[model samples]
Target: MLEELEDLFESSTIRPTFSYVHIILALYIFEKHPEGIGRYRLKENLLIGSGTARSLINKLSEIVDFIEVSGNNKRRGHVLTDKGLRFLKMLKKKIPLLEEGNTKALEEIIIQDKKLNAYICLVKNSADKLNSGIEQRDAAIKVNGSGATCLIFDGNDLKYPKSPNIQNNQVKIGYDLQKYFKLKATEHNTELDKDDVIIVGLGDTSERARLATLNSALTLIE
Candidate 1:
């Protein structure tokens, strides 16, 4: 799945430093800001340089035609095409939940760096693919995140993949997850499955945190 997504950015005429994370983020940005966003604002939201942004926009338009220009000149911006909206819909079906989280509440029970921002996402039915969670952590780190913690919700409790001692803080973590995360999931009309997995991404900035969170969650998908 990861390699398939990465292929979308491939271009014979131009070499792009961007990855699938950037593409997913652009789709998300288009969805959130339907009013249209200029290149500068898009670059700011993506945290990428001018060249990378140009190349990325080109790929999004020329390669996949997911986005089209809106307005004109300085007012020019991008908006998701019907194809892009449908693609985003498919992505959301796989990853139903992705949002920023306040992990400070679980600091006492979960090991978290208070200085970093935290993002939480729920990937439906991906728990079976989770190992010791090292892969998720590595995925986050690849995107400049501090780290990621993967947890699976069985019928009863949320537990670490291979940590027997997880019961020590299992109750507390579950309570906090529901209080801070699950409520948001409910609002989206997406009920999390008992066997779904949750990933918490910790990063220096909010954008990095979100990007890392999605990247880690993607690993659990297939």
Candidate 2:
């Protein structure tokens, strides 16, 4: 993926030094862990000396709106956005898989109890809305609210379903969920042990739905 991205960068005709740095850092962290590379960790892994990862992060932040950094010290960490994930997917197709040691960094992020709670809230509504929108393509339905929803399906029981025709708005949300979860429509429906899966709903309003989902999921994790 990194090699492919390097090729893309080279082909783009932009010769900015920071552009290469940003792409390399983004791909490195992303390839290492699809969830994202936090700022401090990225700095450590990249062996970037002198200037903080913040500079590179700030640059990449302009192009990829989905990379998130948080912490009181401003050294917390970062994660990929749905947009960032799509970027990685594009590169993955072109690059031969590079073998590396099994550090399990990215896997740790998603599987962590606390982080999983965050992801449940962050991803659930988008995922539900996406699925609901797809369902609407087959049967008439209206997406009347901005809030997200959650549903559980048996992973093993879920058979691959056809992709439903989607409207422009629905398509964007659906694509985001698909990219975020790294799963296809059929795969999304597959069931897992309750202990192994957590789902949450992000509703339309920050006050009512989204926050509530976050709190609920956090409680579950706690």
Q: Which candidate's TM-score is highest? A: 1
True lDDT of residue 117, candidate 2: 17
Model 1, which residues run further than 4 Å from truth?
Answer: 1-7, 71-74, 108-110, 164-172
Report the lDDT of model 2 for residue 175: 32
Per-residue lDDT value at 87 in model 1:
84
Give lDDT: candidate 2, residue 159: 15
For model 1, residues 1-222, the per-residue Cα lDDT tens digits are: 444466565668766888777888788888887877777887887778998888888778777788888754337688888988988898888787778877675464347658888888888888778877899999999988989988777766677677655645444255765555567678777876787887888889988889898889878765
| Cα lDDT computed for each candidate against the true fold | 0.78, 0.36
Best by lDDT: 1
TM-scores, in order shown? 0.87, 0.33
